[model samples]
Target: MLDERAAGVFTIAATPFLPDGALDLESVDTMVDFYVERGATGLTILGIMGEAGKLSSEESVAVIARVTARSDVPVIVGVSAPGLAAIRALSLAAMEKGAAGVMVAPPGNLRTDDQIASYFQNVADVLGDVPWVLQDFPLVTGVQITPKVLRRIFDACPTCKMLKHEDWPGLEKISALREQEAAGARKISILCGNGGQFLLEEVRRGADGAMTGFAYPEMMRDITALAHSDPDRARDIFDAYLPLIRYESQPGYGLAVRKYILAKRGAIAHPTARKPGPALSEAAIAEIETLIARQEARLSAL
Candidate 1:
C-alpha cells in the first residue's frame, strides 16, 4: 500500500480510446510500460486526465485491472464519484484488482468547511480499511479545503494517507501544513498535481514529489531529483521545459495534448480523445510543436 513515505513522480495516466471510441485495452498495457520506462515511480489511472467520467463502471474496472497487472510500480486508482456507494464499490473493485490505493476528489456542491469535513468523514466511513488519497484540487472540484479543515479530516480519519495537492497559489498552505507537522500534526505525504507548473516551488515548500499528469514523467523525475540535491541545476532543467509546461497547462485542452504527445512517443496506439471534449485547434497544435522544438533545443544545449 502507498504510505506517507511515498514520493517521486506518480504520473497521472491518460486513458486511450480507439477512433471508434472503444477502450483500447492493448494501449493500456503499452502506456504502463511507457510510464515505467520514463521513470514513474507510481501510476494513477482513471484520473481527471484519464477521462474517468467518460468510462462506464465495467470499463473502469477493466482499465484498473489491466494497469495493475502490467504496472511495475504502485497504481493509484481515482474512484471519485457522486455517491459513497459508487465510490465504495469502485474502490473495492480496484483494491480487489491489486491497486495500491484509491484517490477521491471532493464532490461538487460542497461549499462550507464543515460540509467538506462531513463529506470526507462519510467517505472515510465508506472506505473503511481501504487506504486513500485526498485530492485537494480546488480548480476542478470547486471545493476549497483549508488547512484547518484538512487537519480535522485527517484527525477524524486515519485511512486518508496522501494529499494530491493541486490547489493553485497554495504554496503557503504547504508551508503551513509542514509547520503543523513539525508542531505534532499527523504527517501526510503530499504529492502535488498541476501539470508540473509549480513543481520546483512546491518541492521548496516541502512537497514530497509530483503527482501531476504532464506527459513528460522524466522532467518531473529529473527536476525534483535536482531540486533536492542541487537547486541551481534543478532550475536550469526546469527552465528548459517551463515554456512547454505552460502551454500544456490549458484547462480542457491539456489532456488532449498529453494524448497527442503520448501517441507520437509510441506510448499509445492513437490520440483519439472521447467526445464532448474540445478538439485541438490547428493553432494549438502549431503552438505545441514550436514549444517542443524550443524545449529540445534547450535540452540539447544543457
Candidate 2:
C-alpha cells in the first residue's frame, strides 16, 4: 500500500496546441509551471482533457517528454487507446521518457470485466516496474471497472498504485477501496477525476485528492485548503464555485472553457484546440465570460 500522504491533487492537463494544431511545447511548459506553482502535487498529461485521443502516438510522446524534462514532480502520462500493443507501446514510451507513472483506460466500447483486467495486466507486464493509474472514465471509454475487477487487476499488478476514479458512482468506489485497505488487502489510492463538482464529497469519502480538468489551480487549491481546514467551509466555497464548474463541465465546451480560462489568465497563448472538435459556440463563450466575471467580482468583494 502506498502512503496516502504521497498522493495529492493531480491535474489532468490540457495540451496547448498551436493555431495550426501542432503541439505547443512552450505553452505546455507554462501550464506545467502554472499548476506546480499553485499546489498541484503531480501532472497527468495527454489525458482526456489533454485530448490524447486526438494526438498521434509520436505527438503524445513528445508532449510527455517535454513535461518530464521540465519538472521532477510526478508525471503520469495517459496511455489510452484501443489495441493492447498500442497501449503497451505508449505506456513503455512514457516510462522510458521518465514519467513517474502511466494512466490507462480499458478498450473503448468493450466493457467486459475480463477484457478490462487483461488490458491493464498486459500493459503492466510490458511496463515492468513502472507504476500505473487505472483511469476509470466510463463516459468516454464505455467500460466500467467494477470493484471485483479492480481487485483482480491490483492483485495481478502490484505496481498499479492508484485509480483516477471518474466513474459517477465514485464515492461508492472509494468506499470499497477503503474497505479493502482496512481489511489488510491490497491498497490503492483513489483520486477524484470528475472535475471539482464531486471533489468535496470525494475527499470527505476518503479520496487522496483530485485530478480535474479545470485550469484555474487557484480555485482547486483554495477548495483543497478549505477541505483540509474546515469541511463546512469547503462546502460553502464549493457552492460559490458551482457556477464556474457548470460552465466548464458543459458538453462540447469543457476543454474550450479550460483553454479560454487559461488564456484569460495568460497561462497559454490562445484557447485553441485541434480540429474536428469545434470551437465554443458564441453563447457558450459568453457563459464562460460571465462565470469569470462572477468569480472576479467575488474576489474583488473579498
Candidate 3:
C-alpha cells in the first residue's frame, strides 16, 4: 500500500481512447509498460490527465483493475467525486482490485478551513483503512487548502498518507508543511503535480517527488534522482525541457497536446480526447512539434 515513504515519479497515466472514442485497453497495457520502462516508479491512473470525470464508473473500475494488474510498480487510482458515497464506492473498488491507494481532490464548493477539514475527515471515515492522497490543486478545484488545515486533516486522518501538492505558487506550502512536520505534525509524503513546472523547486522545498503527467516521465525521474547530489546537472536537464514543458502546460488544450505526444511516443495509438474535450488545431500541432524538436536538440546539445 502507498505510504508516507512513497516517492519518485508516479506518472499520471492517460486514458487511451480509439478514434471512435472507445477505451483502448491494448494501449493501456502498452502505456503501462512505456511509463515503467521510462523510469516511472509508480503509475497514477484515473487522474485529471486520465480523463476520469469523462469515464463511466464501470470504465473507471476497468481502468483500475487493468492498470493494477499490469503495473510492476504501484498504482494510485484517483477517486475524487461529488459525494463521499461515490468516493467510498470507487475507493473500495480500487482497493479490492489491487490499487496501492486512491487520490481525492476537494470539491470546488469548499470555502472555510473547517469545512475543508471536515470534508476530508468524512472522507477518512468512509475510506476507513485505505491509504489515500489529498490532491491540493487549487487552480482546478478552486479549493485552497492551507498548510494549517492540512495539518488538521493529517492529524485527524491516519490513512491519508500522501499529498498531491499542485497549488500554484505552492513551493512555500511545501516548505511550511515540512516545517510543521518537523514540529511534530503528521509527516505524509508530498508529491507535486502542476505538470511538473515547479518540480525542481518543489523537490528542493522538501517534496518527496513528482506526481504529474509531464509526458516525459524520464525527466522527472532523472531530476529527482540527481536533485540532491548534482543540482547543476539537474537544472541543465530541466532547462532543456522547460520550453516543451511550458508549451504542454497550457490550460484547456494541455491534455490534447499530452495525448498527442504520448501517441507520438508510441505509448498510445491515438490522440483522441473524448467528446467535449478540446482537440488540437493543425497550427497547435505544428507548434508542439516545433517545440519538441527544439527541446530534443537542446537536450542533445546538453
For candidate 1, write residues 1-302 as lDDT tens digits: 97888999999999999998999999999999998998899999999989999999999999999999998899999999988999999999999999999999998899999999999999999999999999999988889999999999989999999999999989999998999999999999999999999999999999999998887899999987888789988999899999989878888888788888889888999999998776787888898889889999999998
TM-score of every candidate: 0.98, 0.93, 0.99
Ranking by lDDT: 3, 1, 2
State each model's CA lDDT, in order: 0.92, 0.80, 0.93
Clashes of each: 0, 0, 0
Off by over 4 Å in 3: none
TM-score of 2: 0.93
- Model 3, CA-based lDDT: 0.93
**Which pairs of residues clash in candidate 3, taking residues 3 or more apart in a chain or in different chains?**
none
C-alpha-based local distance difference test score of model 2: 0.80
* lDDT, model 1, position 226: 84
True-structure RMSD, every candidate: 0.9, 2.1, 0.8
Q: For model 1, where is the 10-residue window of minimal lDDT? A: 276-285
Q: Is candidate 1 or candidate 2 better by lDDT?
A: 1
Q: How much is the lDDT of residue 97 in candidate 1?
A: 97
The number of clashing residue pairs in model 2 is: 0
